[model samples]
Target chain A: MVKEQIKPMTSRERVLAGLRREPVDRTPVCNPTSVATVELMDLVDAHFPEANRNPEMMARLAATGYTEIGFDSIMPVFSIIQESSALGCKMQWEQKDNWPTVRMREPIWRDVEDVVIPNDFLTHPDTACVIECIKILKKEYGDDVAIIGKTMGPWTLGYHCFGVEPFLLMSLDDPGKTKLALERMKEATIQFGMAQIEAGADALTVPDHATGDLVSGEYYDRYLKDMHAEFVDLLPVPLILHICGRTVDRMNSIAETGIAAFHFDSKNKPQESMDIIEDRISLVGNINNPETLYAKGPDAVRDEVCANLDAGVHMVGPECAIPLQTAIENLTAIPNAVKEWHSRRESH
Target chain B: MADLQDISNEKIRQEIEEFVENPDEIERNIETFARVRPLMQEIAAALIEGDDGTVDALTKQALEDKIDALEIMDDGLIAAMGVVGIKFRDNYIFVPEVLACARAMKAGMAYIEPILSASGVEPLATVIMGMVKGDLHDIGKNLCIMMLRGSGFNVVDLGVDTSDDEFIDAVEEHSAPILGMSALLTTTMPNMGKTIEAFIDADMRDDVKIMVGGAPVTQEFADDMGADAYGKDALECVAVAKGFLSVQA
Candidate 1:
């Protein structure tokens, strides 16, 4: 039994309390998404390009998300290249300051017939590193700060695996072939997801780019709805479904998928997004990353935090994986704003 | 075989249209590619042969047949993407299709760049672009550069992890009026503000309009940082650049 009059203690405590939907003394400033900071890059000696691929370095930088920056969770494997890299796509490892990207000039799976998830997929160095990082975090932090693991959704992986152009062509040319490719990619999603869960991750962020960008809400309903629902059912832990870009159009269906929470983007306003998906799901965001978190000062970060708290978001965070260069002062101010808001509310 | 010849031109035309409306179709249907290859080769031959009227008629027929402008880049692929961008903004198309069209446009652009440069057509604006200091994320930056180039801006890409001095010097050398800064991380985003402050301290604020973007940026933050604009993404950056130039006019 919990007392209604209890006040929030710390960000860690506030987040755990919120996981149960219990009334916290204040809002929690947990980034269930990536919180890569430059300080961490130097601290770990594993910067971008390498951290974007190598598991050991990936874990080190991810650890800074919790140990160094005071974020409530550590998210390893920052980029979305695992499935594509494993699927044999050519990657351009630009340099330290740039995250590695799939070179789309030559897509791996030229045709639907060529698409297949590798058998030794789990043992792949990058995939193995993500699982290892989660396991290591679980061992180190135990249950103190949640360890959020990322497994690219099959659709997103499909974008990199077959090259965006080839995949889109298959989607239009032969719908069945596109379905075939997605079906194969799902094995990678499920296998990686289960591995992370087994590796001691408290939660898993299933990032499927089901934005209104390339695919329609109808596409999500038709392809991902059932798979996501099943993932939630089988995973046996909180699943945070993160989709980039404006996704308000699919709030109804996303809520219906039984995900514990939806990590949203700034493209959708916090109040409007909350109004749309409040009761159906636990809303986690609406902070404008580019304008507020990335470009402004701590003052602006605090303002956005208070606004999100006012909008009744179950959790407040950056709209997405925060850029590596975001000011630490802006991020550290998140917890402070939540605390001030609660204190003001209590006094009133 | 007789029907193949009877409808060869029509078949090539239809294939070209599918290639235009959906660039993905060009990769999937090998037969369509084979059929169109000869016609495209003939058009290239005609262009080489100096048969202007024949090339014009074939190009128009190809377009009517639904030839993607990208496939006919020596023809006018930019016009096709312009159509795609309009359709995209109007909600008639989606991201994947737009991406496909962009790819097609890129392919065509590759073929046309040298020729276009030789024609002495000046770009609308000269823009300096880069990912801000301490941030390595470049998707948003690259996309903006592509869009800027597509929209007729002479883009000087400074690559990722650029320091304030690098930006100031680039502006000095290129005489660029717009400095587009991007940061994908919250930590790096503040660098945008710092960079803008550098420009101001150098008394270059009046000379350049600073535009900031990436996942974490907002318009309010841009205003707070004294940046001229905050583009939500690459597309918005184009509109902002165009608007800024218009204001100059």
Candidate 2:
């Protein structure tokens, strides 16, 4: 145990440093998805819907997360709708600063046979903006700040293209159809993932909704188990898997995914989840974003962060993308908590 | 050994037949603290077989037989689900099977709810549930609704991406005693508190209890927001809601 003195580093260095398993001066506070706020929308003039898709505006607004809150990284893309938009789902582009949502009433694919990964999918503006944002961040910060990119998993793509109710029903009635859908969508996952890796993204977050509500751990094994393992093989950089809900059920399988880490939810106990992962991969978070970061103040954020830090996650962050209205002080408290934890550990 | 084995076999056969013919009776007995493990296995099979009509018929019989809904949830279905949930917790079962059981439970509930509603079973309390603004994640919110309903509360689900004004409107519309707010994203979680503040501004905070849950929430944070309760999962939400409603009584 060669303990060394720690110092402040840039967000890019802090994140990349952690990925490499090197000692970081302090924990990096970065979300691989947008932490866009309504305040940022007014500041950068890059509101949602477009901020979710446009490169320049997206970068400008995302930068606020880094500039204003002192997070180690900036994420441009706001929602998982991009992959579905490319996959041909009917989209409702809401107001500026609002993420576009897929209209489930109008599913693009009624059946698995209708699913296809378009050849020019990566070149789509929604996809291209992410790449452009990465480039903009790289050029602007020049290795000072980490640029996080995001891609949708095949399951999330399945939700957008096939619709939530339809997709769940297909999985129930015809397992074969569900497999077929996930398989065809795998190419989209790979294509977008590779493009982001090629761009200046320090890491990429793959958020799939393998929740306890809609599906079981068996579904993760039947579908996502191997697919996630394949993602570890395909992507060149560190990959983080973010799933919503009480995913303690799938923790063991998720630990086996061979990705760099798993970003978990607060519904999961930090100590219990830690015991499950057991150092198989770096753990990112289980912060109570709604109750702590969103509803409460910075002091509450600090309390939750210390709990996760004490539980031994590799990084500390909001459990997921933060609410648009979360106060800046609350977001900054994550890093502050990390720093306080480090100091406390040293004194002990 | 042979005599014990023969007796066990006879018991099992009789239990299986009863489970197949009278699942509702088994559920009702379970409410009275009678063990329904064998019957639960039978119901699980019926569910996996997708015998919707059989499940419906059995559910109706259970209501007729006076099976306590909450007891059925705890002793029969959720108990079976506990098996699935444990396997899921262990990675032995995956998303598909869990979803299947959830569907089966939902199917059973659909049959049971109308009966429970008609029985004029007064809810322990009325809870208005919703997701706050700038968030579309409802899976957690939906789970809490099921647990709240199962625990004997009448829940008014306002659905996802709800604004402060909408929550205020629901509180007035339903005249509910408790409010449960949920958000999956850190970004939307604070809106839960702001929504609470809105209630305060409208002078409606005194009349209602506020409970918050989701992937991003914490109890300490709930306290900071002046929320009455904080639930970690859907099951916990039921316990918390029950506690609050009981306190009021």
Candidate 3:
């Protein structure tokens, strides 16, 4: 544990301990989501949308989170559409300047009966790319740092496969049908998550995307709370639940989830989120992605890091994927702030 | 006697509050609807209920009964949409609910658009809106368009991956005074500045007011690009466009 450390801790040990809500030498500098940037891609010669499909480029690019940005964890999966791609959702593999997104306009499945997990779901290029990247990172940096992996939760999968408008309409119009579709779709989340763990991920970021923009807190409790609790039970390793937007309304329900940590957004204040969660789960993230990391300088980034540290947030990083154009100085500011924070306290 | 006297007011309160959860929004909506005629109030209620077919039928009925088109537009469609916008901003509802309300408002507007055009009733303002180049996310842009059209702005959508030249030409063609840019990616946000630069190069920057928005956009970034205003979301975009026109007027 960090409080009684006789020797210095490894990045991976610090992160795992933080997830367990155990003592840490300091708050771990980590992001369970994408920290990929256009500059980082240029540094590694690993640009997207190719890097998203190619395992070698993916691993190389992900390693920079450690070697370059000084994050305690390396997350290879940047976009949320890998498993959706494997599941045969229409894809728009955008240029290097844009994120590759699911062609949500062209939905694949409509009815609960139409939900199908392919027999070769794990072997398809997109899903398999993630697995291969994890294997490479584990072989290389597994001992040194945590290789975080991503798997789309069923609610997000429902959006990708069923289209956003149609899926939400289904949820609103027919509760039973929507629940059945989510039930049928959850296997894909589990299979892909397990495959990455088998390939040696120390933790998994299961991005459910029960976004606060569309879904209500009541809907989150009604639809995803039990499912997320089940995911914690099924996925053996440490689990992180990521939901975007102003999700403070669902914090109580989220705390009910047996997840190891909640990868929260910057919209929620860190101290308030810690109060709501009250040690039910570890908290990760909440540095503003758009303004602070992408547009502002290192000083702004440092201020955000210090706020999360002050709030006793377990891990600190960008609220979501860093915009591909984020400056290296802003990305590097994270760990530097954490180190400075600990040293300043010790001096006091 | 007091209880009986407040009965009608209380009913209107409960009815509007049924759709609107926020207290401030309900009071504002109640005040806006108070002067509206009963037939127009019926139309507003249907629009707020997201009953597109009912809005369609009732709007057509109001038209046949020789009610003024602008009155229906303002008291019925626009007033209800104001409530929808407030509810959305307050998290009382979200994208799907707003989409439904926009659809209902559209149904009512369909009957009014032809009449308004024939009578030469001017739009609030002509605003040009588009997603910046390389940013394909359209949910935010489409939502803004819906709210703009509902709020009586004549919006010319330039669609996703909009080039600076496209923006420049649209302004010249439409003689539009307001230009709005949206980008959902950080990599593409700089393109907002680039488009503004294109306007400057074309010597048309002063002719049109510029507003920028999306998930990743901010007021500081908008200021950096020398934009006239920045909106955080769809409803706010309507307010920004209105502000631009109000300033122009």
Candidate 4:
């Protein structure tokens, strides 16, 4: 079958079109999560702890996804602990080579009533940095590329504020209380999401860590599906829900959420994930980070990019946050392979 | 699902029969629960359902009824977890479900441990487990600990972000012959090899059998790290520990 000739899209048009499941010249190489590596940080002189807390540095480091690696989108929220930091969880700001994490053992909230979005939640330095980074990227890139901002979903915040064990135990011990806790915590997500949108984010990745390894699909249905749908209505920009690990079980429910897309994990086969979502929501993902990108070479990376394209994944990128030391060549290979795949398809 | 309160032995056996769609897949020793006394089967069912209260209360009742603690543990709690492990490995359940089952197993173990210890029988074997240094993720390690304990191994859970010194100290302190290390990040994964090298430097490499696991760990990575075995999940963690114990025996 001969394919019609297609025109090339600007990064912004390509990414937004892919998210909307609209036809694009080719699949956009997008990382809704962090593509910030120690190498990228060094190149930009914007290492973490500072890159995570300073807007200019954050933007500089994040810009490499577009500038250096050539992904269609630049995502600045490199760490998931921003809202948690703003909301009072103690932050373990690690060195340049490590991703910062919330110190969950020192949980800040004990119950639903204690789930407070601090007075300066959005204005807090860490959270503010994300918004400021988005603003900077928007001013700099404008319509040339899609600037994707991230807001932590409440389930993930529950782990940060309440402690992973305490929050999970609460969910198992009392589903009703877990529901109420997530309901209250979701305000932080909305508040942060709206701030990013106001700062000129074209899309927001609502990363709820209902990871397939840790939480059941049934738990997702009970706690997060409705909340995510509410996020679509509440957050102004295109919403891409990112959940890590094998998530095919919840793809149907995730598809029904009316979100713009789901950034999937490498554990899920791209074709099977496509068959499950069935174009209900566009899929953006799922190149293996640890094995393929972090450990292997560009050839292995291309193989995954081809797999995602073959499966009709709407966009293609690393599964989650790429490791801090991931090779530059391996990272760049994503967009290169996507373009090559498109060119080959057109030639056929 | 049948009402959890319907705790009769026959009903519990029927529940196990129902919960375990493929009985043949369970270990041969665990499959013997099918022929055990009804109360034991009921205990197994409560544990499988993750009803810690039911498992705890029924375990005490089984003790009061003079059932052997070992019999209760082997045929009841461990048997139930055997099914839970298979279900988890097969993707019929997930972390939350496995965690719930582990909690129930712990509750039943709380009643069984003292009696088993008093009976003067040595633990099945001693194993030390921890998440490698710089990696704080322990959900996988904790799950393996729970499954190891449930499967009759005395597990020394060194917890998350454990350094090589901590691992060596725990092994030396506990005199554990088997060591299990877990890491969730590729960056911290090399620390497992570092820990093994530390063991070699300390001249304790042959003193313990080493197993490695976590989301990012592959058999190739395990071999590269000089680990004796690599478990893909909590179930495989238990199986590897069992294999280590059998080899030592």
Candidate achieving the largest DockQ: 3
State the C-alpha lDDT per candidate: 0.71, 0.73, 0.87, 0.87
Write down the lDDT that model 2 would get: 0.73
Greater lDDT among 2 and 4 belongs to 4
Models, CA RMSD each: 9.6, 6.7, 2.9, 3.3
Docking class of 3: medium
Candidate 3 per-residue lDDT, tens place, B1-249, comes to 122223234434555656567666655676677777777877877776788999999999999999999999988888878877777877778777777777788899888999999999888888899988877667788888988887888999998788999999999999999999998777789999999999999999999999999876889989998898999988788878888767421
In candidate 3, list every pair of residues with a backbone clash. Answer: A38-A324
Candidate 4's error at A106, in angstroms? 3.0
lDDT of 1 by residue, B165-213 (tens): 9999999899999989998655566678889889889988799988988
Local accuracy of candidate 1 as per-residue lDDT tens digits, A1-348: 123477545545666566556676666566766777665688779787778666677778888766766666677867777767776787766565445667664567776677787887888877787888778777877557777788888788877777655666567557777777777778788888899989998777889987775677777887788888988887777888999887888888998988888888877778888788757677777666666665679899888888888888878788787766667777777767876877788677
| Residue B162 lDDT in candidate 3 | 89
> For candidate 3 chain A, which ten residues in a row score worst on lDDT?
A1-10
Query: Which regions of candidate 2 deviate over 4 angstroms?
Result: A1-11, A25-27, A90-100, A104-106, A212-215, A267-280, A297-300, A303-312, A337-348, B1-50, B56-249
**Pairwise TM-score winner, candidates 2 and 4:** 4
Candidate 3 lDDT over A1-348, as tens digits, reads 236443577899889988999888887989888988889999999999999999999999999999999999999999899999999998989888678988787899989999999999999999999999999999999998999999999999998999887888778768999999999999999999999999999999999988787778999999999999999999999999999888899988998988999999998999999999988898999999878888789999999999999998988888988888889999999999999998898787
Instruction: For model 1, give the RMSD to the true fold.
Output: 9.6
TM-score of chain A of each: 0.92, 0.95, 0.98, 0.98
Point to the candidate with the largest TM-score: 4
